[model samples]
Target: MTTETPVKTSNWNVPNALTTLRIVMVPFFGYALLHDGGDSIGWRITAYVLFALAMVTDKIDGDLARKHNLVTDFGKIADPIADKAITGMAFIGLSIVGSQSGEAWYVAGGEIWWWVTILVLVREWSVTLLRLSIMKDVVIPAAQLGKIKTTAQGVALGLLSLPLVADDNAWGDTGRVIFYVSQVILAVAVGLTLWSGYEFFRDAFRQKRAARA
Candidate 1:
């Protein structure tokens, strides 16, 4: 009887391509989001489309990689980076839009708070950095809470990316409704964001402590 060895899959695959495409889309998405200082209604709509594309591609690539056994080192690294890049751009760009719009921007009490952006980004990046730093020594696998956080964030940010108010500060009834809904969703996301961060740090610290013991 002869023993067969497992074959190593090549990195050139659909999932990796999608991940790379997502990374490439980040800047273009940001550009569209911030076009005309976030006042270009057309560009804001364009940005929303681009953002939706990124989110869909992200889901597709991850599914493809898992289903086809095409998971590679590159995918692992680039996938999270792509996710972070797109969302980070959304947060920052939306904040800029909110700051520029002033009182008129407060449609139905909807505005992207700079403090919220900073807090969420800090928690998100800190987790990513710590995960990468201790990946070899202590693997802290992602929790389900993280997925919920991501989904909530995606929905909220996508809504906020739209030009919810006119340049002249006239907010339509529908626009106001949507803006208020998005803000409510964002508040939920922020809560989840903090809770998930706490879970991640708790798990990471426990793992590290166990390893040292």
Candidate 2:
């Protein structure tokens, strides 16, 4: 009698590969921005271009994973980590550049008076810690509002990386104004993110109680 080898069941297939690729792009994106040499149009354009490519990969990875039923433990965990890495790093990086270069900071329509970048970074880590605490028991599903909040954040981050100075001649003051608008949008997104985290905890606790009963 011949024995056959057993195959392991895994979500780590083609779709997951793509998701992993997207995660890998986060560091490359950061490097692109950090290495950009100047306030020149070409350099800024290159930075923005790389950022856009990374963002596109982010969307593609998720879509492919869901479409192909390739969602994995790795994908689920790593996807969010990639998102936080890219967005958080970009925001902090841009803020440092802005502060060092003396650029105005705005989120949506509001001005960020304090160290807004630091606040966002802290918030992301805090929320991640809370979610990890929940995950030790059961996986918390993403809320609809949380999805919207994330979309807003991606848009805001993309806009933040825009080379506003490149258009200073014609757009002049308009570019500065648009930058502030993007900032306000980000601030609002953060608020929504916090609210969704509260909901996640509330539901998780309820589930735990029900399980005990």
Candidate 3:
């Protein structure tokens, strides 16, 4: 009888490479944000562009993995870490920069609050830990609401990241208008973040109970 050789699979594939690239981009994105203290319009624009490119990689990597059956443990783990690092930096950086500026108002004629960032961080980290706790027992796939929350956060952060208008400039009025709209979107994202967190916990606990039964 002729012997058949088993197909060998490697973990280092296009999807994982892209995910690692995204992680590599995080420092560059942060540098672009902090290099000029986020005051220079050019640097701020560069940061936004880098962030957008990183976000694109997030989508492309996952799609490539699914299409090519190249998904791996490393990709699954690194992907979310990259996402949280990028998005978390965006929110924190925006809030810090806006706090420093005298004219960074949100929808309610107030500065972007740190509590918003804190709340989002708490939810994100808490859910992440929760997942790790149940990783072996249950697979908690991302829900549809989670996707919407990510999109909303991405758009809102993108708008907020741009340094298009100054308070005294002619474009200030337009920029304020856009800022208000972005804040509304951010609010929706925050709402979804909390809602999805609740769903995750609820499902996780229910699953645990069922498993114990």
Our tally of clashes for model 1 stands at 0
lDDT, residue 18, candidate 3: 83
Task: Determine which window of 10 residues in candidate 2 has minimal summed lDDT.
Answer: 105-114
| Lowest summed lDDT window (length 10), candidate 3 | 102-111
Go through the candidates in order and give each one's C-alpha lDDT.
Answer: 0.85, 0.67, 0.79
Q: Which is better, 2 or 3, measured by TM-score?
A: 3
lDDT winner between candidates 2 and 3: 3
Candidate 1 residue pairs in backbone clash? none
User: What C-alpha lDDT does candidate 3 achieve relative to the native structure?
Assistant: 0.79
32-94: candidate 1 lDDT, tens digit per residue: 988877878788889999999999999999999999899887887888889999999999888
Clashing pairs in 2: 106-183, 107-183, 107-184, 108-181, 108-183, 108-184, 108-185
Tell me how far the alpha carbon of residue 67 in candidate 3 is from the true structure, in angstroms, after superposition: 1.1
Best by lDDT: 1
Q: Give the TM-score of each candidate.
A: 0.91, 0.78, 0.88
Model 1 regions lying over 4 Å from their true place: 1-5, 108-111, 168-171
